[model samples]
Target: MKRLIPLLLLAAVPALAAPVAAPHVAARSFEQLAKPLPLPYAEGADADAAVAAAKARARQAHKLLLIDLGGNWCLDCRLLAGTIELPDLNGWVKRHYEVVTVDVGRFDKNGQIPAHYGITGRLAGVPAVLVVDPRTDRLVNKGHETALSDARSLTPQALADWLARWV
Candidate 1:
């Protein structure tokens, strides 16, 4: 059993180490991304409202929290959001930090967001998950792309790892 454990991990490493859809997204051009992207959640709530509440919660919480710097209009953002909110992944996430999401489109014009974090000119991609310190507004972690776009490819697990950096 012990000897086979190495083999088991070896077998799993390739599957887990890289994303399945990375190549497709990495190869895509800006024109490909110009279309509508899907997201896990609705643009149901206001971005500032959501962030305000999450930041308020983080004020009292002692864990390292994440501020997802993306929006519901993005594919990579949606994929990452769905993964983190999954039962098992959320279990791990809740253990380490609080979470909030910022809408790149709406928040960019505000002074609260840095110019570098702006999703302008080029395609910002929906799910550029940026981990930040809610208390201090310092950036801690971020992920760029997923299989949805050609310029960047990201998988759920790969996205989770990036969010893990914030946690």
Candidate 2:
């Protein structure tokens, strides 16, 4: 009876834990992604204004603010941007986040964006994703900002999974 009680308690543990949501991805592989991945960064646009607008929208919509800091020249940044725009993932992202892209040209421009979230010094790389909570205006994923810096190495589903984690 004692052994059976322990087994029953062990079984209950799984039920008590939170369930992880599966990533929504349309593409099965990276090769299947659309040709000439999108150049999302707008060097000519005002990044500060864009971020402020996004934050306001996020607060009003009760969604998280997703700041995508990268340059058009970075292949990994483009890959990450392309993956996020995938049909299935795009819808999910739109539902949960107000996204803004800031062009950090060769890590020289838009230094204030990351600094606003207390990320000082040299960035790890391009495609630094900042997930901010609209209510508090705090960075949710602090240390993991550069997690997708090497987007080329991740599968489409893996990229979606990474974004889903913040949601």
Candidate 3:
């Protein structure tokens, strides 16, 4: 009977361990931090027109144009988007850069945007960011376009610091 009781308890162990849901942070919006989260990338969108409009807006606003190059399918891209959408950071981005999301679908679509910035090949990874000075259309942070590529590993503070540096 003792051995049978032990075996019964062992058999119930899996049932006893219930799955736990992650605790939600109060400040994060539903759209900002949802699972398979909502990102701001437009698939098959025209990068040229987007850039041109952003350039005009940046020129008028006297701000840099921040081109977020990635697809909606990328988790890192979505993470970066969510990080930037944080209330404080969102205001900073609006003040300093005219943000544009250029969707590079599986490294297939929207290759021209980066090419326009003189990068001939496909990017090192998704969420390749390009901060361009509207006045000269220069790539301000040339090699660091993939700074946010490792969004999964970066802390919110690190991302904020990176954004602040360019501003």
Candidate 4:
């Protein structure tokens, strides 16, 4: 029984030692990838009212409203924010969408914002993005809620391309 115990343990070692798969992050140049920073989701504010204000601005600007739904604790969410803030893309984003970061605190805060856009709660994960046409009060990208949730896996160029597609 002692010999059998050693063999059993040895057999289990490989399973335990197997490497976990790393998250898929697309390659990017240092200049292309913005440095990660703290998420800038406003705390204790009515998300709906904020979106409404953004919608009004979008209407006047003849642009779309981008409602970014996520929280400060979400790494992917922060990554997306940084990627979008890159100088080249940041200007493009400003020209195209009135961006608003709605903090869904650990999925406990402002969940209704997604529901308002027909996303229920979340699409795939935190950092769900919705592009809304202020002119029509309609969701432009309905099924692509999780498009930017994997910002770590996407290069800055890829993120820019995605944003450009909507415009």
Top candidate when judged by lDDT against the true structure:
2
State every prediction's TM-score relative to the real structure. 0.53, 0.86, 0.78, 0.77
Candidate 4 TM-score versus the reference: 0.77
Worst lDDT run of 10 residues, candidate 2, spans: 14-23
Ranking by TM-score: 2, 3, 4, 1
The C-alpha RMSD in Å for every predicted model, in order, reads 10.4, 5.8, 18.4, 16.5
Candidate 1 residue runs with Cα over 4 Å from true position: 1-44, 71-73, 104-123, 142-152
True lDDT of residue 164, candidate 3: 65
> Which parts of model 3 are misplaced by more than 4 Å?
1-36
Across 133-158, the per-residue lDDT of candidate 2 in tens digits comes to 98889998989999999888889999
What lDDT tens digits, residue by residue, belong to model 4 across residues 1-167?
98999888977864344433322234364344555565678878789899989989999998889999888888778777877766666777787789988988778888888887677744568788888888878887788878888777767777777776566
State the lDDT of candidate 3 residue by residue for 126-159, as single tens digits: 7899999998899988889987888777666567
Tell me the deviation in Å of residue 141 in model 1: 3.0
lDDT of 2: 0.88
Name the candidate, 1 or 2, with the larger lDDT value: 2
TM-score of model 2 (CA atoms) = 0.86
